[model samples]
Target: MNQNIFENISDLITSGAFLEAEQAAVDLLEEIESKDDGSQAFVIFKFNVAGFLVDIGHALSNRGYALKAVEIFESLEPRIEGVIDPHQYFYNRANAKCHIVEQVSTFDLTFSSIETLVEAKNEYWKSIKEARKVNEEFPEQYVNLANCLKRQFRLSEALWYYDSIREMAPEIPQSWINRSEALLMLNTVSNSYSGKMLHEISSGYNQASRSKFLPPDYAAYYGEQAERFRQGISENDHAETKKEFEELSEYRKYCCRSSLTLSEHGLYCSCAGAARDNLTIPLAATTVGGAFVPQMEAVLNRLKSEFSMARRCYFEYTEAEIEIDLIHEECFTDLETNECLGLDFEKLRTAFRLCFGVLDKIGFAICEHHSLKPKSGMVYFQNFWQLDRDNRREKFEEIKTPGLLALYSIATDLNEHKNGEWKNFKRLRNAMEHGFLVIVHPGSVDDIFGAYELSGDVELVELDVFEKMVEQMIQLTRSAIFSFVFHFRQKGLEESVPTGPTVSFQRVNLQM
Candidate 1:
């Protein structure tokens, strides 16, 4: 029973049923204790069960239940001494710890302790050391170690490990991702030196008297010898100034050229292109204000595609109506027979409703992408408009810019008036989505009709008017998205100050 129990548990875990395997392990342990009380068989069975449980722990960790997996692994720590391989046990434990740290960093709002990060870093280091004893060439150990170093702000050390992985396994996409991420961090740190000149002047040291300090003109007189000591502190062409500006420009290019790709799951880079089979759109790796550029691109692309499809459907419906009109006016024997000729008003209605639905979707997408606050899952586009209004009003008060204030005024008017354009649009969308009966009254002119919801008193105008309304809404949404993207881009650039000085200084003792 004990021998077969392990096999059964392994099968469950292999099939991605972690919960069932955990329950089975518990049931098997209880059965063994009840039947084989204090017997040698019970001890051997428990040890074997403990080893199987370790595998389950690792599986749970991989499946994103890192905290639970850590708990399971910790419980088996006492029994793991002789039951499992030291390298395997330590490696799994280390990976689980790293996952927990990552989860906490990303999602846990309550955890802000530095000690937790340090603990995770130590565990990763310990795991790497243990794994190396058995297999020095293990790639996972190096990768995990690199991530650990990066999390601890050890950028240079992290780069070393990432470079090592790239050299060893050049085909791995993660190696390139990690290398690029480290380079970005290093660039940010090196370029963040805004008040360097101010600081140098404030230090109260005379530039000419300072050792090895050559003013701007000193380079022309001393020729090559002066070129080496010339400082960039002056306005003119000093050798040191040329070197500084060139280095800064190079760093800026590196930062700007960093690109990310959007897939179904999340943001990736060109390095992951080979691994992904889904649609991928490449975008600059900059943040649009607080919003990410890749995410913004994905939302905008989806909105544009939906809008285009709706426009095509509208054109098709209009074309069908025009053909029916021509047939009745010129080809048909009697005008009355046009009605009996079997025009599919239902299909046209369906197409019109679809256009409305797409317009509503665009509004919701715009709100979701730009809103600073989390949206309510219950209400769709209503919440977005409300939040956007609030944000615009707040910004207007702070900056009092005329253009922003005008936008704020529009939002205010929309919110204040019950029969506002945005409100009418929202109510119409709600009716259509909730299965309210939509009636279309045919107009005297061909290809024109009045559409309205059964529950609402509002009467929509002719087909052309409706089309114009939809077109206006589509244009408004498009403009809003572009404006938000531009606003965020400017904000992000403004806030992105360098973290440290590009130049380094050394202290020397001077005796005069």
Candidate 2:
């Protein structure tokens, strides 16, 4: 490897000529690859080359070319396995994705932006796992992960991450600022926990404001936020908040009552309410308005119905009573040699299948609403985000609804991530769709495997694991439904009203 070439690339990066640096780095990487002499010295040079590529990626990210930075990192992924520290590589990738997320406009959902954020979250998780293997603690990774969770609107999980960081590294000013920001966001949505945490939140901001590590502008911002929060303490309306909760509908109350409540699941009842309340009126006939209104309403209605069914089946599977005869006889196998039999719960299976089906249906709805034409006239939830990988930014990306973006994130999770919960669900769904799926006893398998690992033609899943998959799928489906309705509702609100004369249609009430 030529040392001068590496030096030139570094100098270019230092001079903020990132485009030149990127090109030089790519050319050098190609030259190194082409001249692999299979020598020990050459092998060591490759690792050095890997580190240099990482630097190039960082420089591109700094230059606000985060997507380009991501592309560069992705190019390195094939050879990165043993060349670099996997944790460090993933952390760097996560940071690049976070940069993309930050640059994304608050409106106009782009595939790269929201999907990148989800990818960043997954990469951070991989980094966390790698760190855990070596018994290493990195507060910055936790803070970044918390920030990702906050951006995803998972306030409860974000708060937990922030609290964990504070306990381990209280001196970190960013964690305090991030926690305070999450609290402020929570206050706007729900008073359930915000009112109780207001004083502590204000104090956190105050502490952040005093930190010398933060820039002067940042410190002043925190100080103003702290004072503003402190003022809210004097005008707190606990009575009104309590009354609001009291007035919550049965559905909202049920959502709040779950073990994984509204906040924990990232599914807000307020979002669903906003869509349902405002979208009830029938619209006047126009070129597309009339068709859009009915279609949107129908999709919303089906989403609610599907979610209700999935939730009911899930609950019945977990909590409903069953006859002793309904249990398989093999379930009573002796403890020492126990590899019991699968319990045949139709409700659980129904819930799992329904959850999978509903997601695909939502994809179809999105395609219809956006007038998006999928390749081969086929659209699955997994492939709904992009039909052509080459054309990364499709027309669908123009819809910048937050909930819809979240929906796409869920699709990314199910389709891409190898996390057991999501991967298992996808595997099971695939088996049901194109292969045979069989349930085995919970203890039958020493470890879980994908649907492709089949005995003859059937894929076997542990009964308990299948049950858990059903439970999670139900929750995911619920979140997807909320995202579909709420985000589109938000998009509707953001658009300017029509100024020209329009026909008015009477509000039609459907009899149940």
Candidate 3:
């Protein structure tokens, strides 16, 4: 508890030297334990020493050293509980446990990690409860508690905390963000209920509080109520109405007690309002780059920028897909039709144009990254083969570059498909650009459907076959991006793009 030593350890923690701070705190604790006389002055010093240990433990946890931090916090728990402010003690302890959970989640999870996660959830609850007892308006604790519930997949409970914060402090964006996330998760579960029911259900309360044991016929009875609520909310704008209906349907499916039997009692009741707690405070404004090594930071920034552009392109492609689907839904009876007579050929042509546009952007992205130039047309088959041959001839004759090889392989395999869809994709794209009137067809004619002009057929390409080709191209575009990132990292131009959770894109359903 020497003043100079205490300040030095604090400085180390502030400077992100967590290991040094931990070691200094440990040495200080040992010195305090080895004191010859247990005098009043020494006892006072012991309290300050314990505070240092807690601070060091917290610092370690903040820097991703969760396991080590948990050990320090656990060891000092009994001594630090009543000696220091109980709120601070519980808060730091909870944070250390939360960090442990975060670290465990980053790995391939195992049975052992489940127990650790449960412990972390319990600690977060304890910390929130303690903070509430001391100061009910402590918002940071509520944010942490809500976030913990979210990580636990207790979305209903998490939404309760988020909503509570929103009600208390409507101006805070994080609470709204968290609540929207919960709502989106719930909406994914169901999308057919009414707005009022959505409000009632998302409130995390049992509408029929006294009716715990719903009869077997409850679904039929509640179905009527849900229908009435849906009609009531339908007066709102279309988008808002749809959103509320979806959320309400989801709530009824998973949350409404009337939809449950006696045995299922208390199963979804954990999110009820009476059991809910929350607080509010101004949001903390901070960024997290200074913690990373300078080399890693530069690499991460560049990759992030590149991936962001790729992501935007992907998003545009997805939007085009949705638009095409909508057009098809409006115009055609069977979505899988090879030909739909009387369908607006103009709309079909425009849809195909959008789909082909995505391919061009994806191709350009790859060529630009590899420093290759295509004089004309999309860099699909011909350009890829040329680049592959040039790279092998100039760079390494024996071993092909992995990234280039991957790109060439994908392009070659797609082009040589047994169904000849890729060939039709190229033919149709070229025909469209050259002033031929594109026509939709269900099946191939003479291996490819021909584009027409006022006088004669100008080019031949099949639309039905091209459907499968488009799907493959989407996947290939994704793989091409992955290969480029891999090549960049392998070249040591930048350290490996920091690992994160695998990005999963949901399949878009074109059929209604």
lDDT tens digits, residue span 330-355, model 2: 34534332233344366677778888
**Which residue ranges in model 2 land beyond 4 Å of their true spot?**
1-89, 100-105, 112-118, 128-143, 149-220, 230-254, 257-291, 312-350, 387-394, 416-424, 438-455, 461-475, 494-512
Q: Candidates' lDDT values, in order?
A: 0.42, 0.61, 0.44
Task: Show where candidate 3 strays beyond 4 Å.
Answer: 1-64, 103-110, 132-137, 170-512
**TM-score of each model, in listed order:** 0.29, 0.59, 0.30
**How displaced is residue 291 in candidate 3, in Å?**
53
Of the candidates numbered 2 and 3, which has the greater TM-score value? 2
Q: Between the candidate structures 1 and 3, which one is better when assessed by lDDT?
A: 3
Q: What's the C-alpha lDDT at position 109 in model 2?
A: 39
What lDDT does candidate 3 reach at residue 439? Answer: 48
List, residue by residue over 39-60, the lDDT tens digit for candidate 3. 5456446555555555555544
* TM-score for predicted model 3 compared with the true structure: 0.30
Q: How many pairs in model 1 have backbone atoms within 3 A of each other, for residues 3 or more apart or on separate chains, i.e. clashes?
A: 2
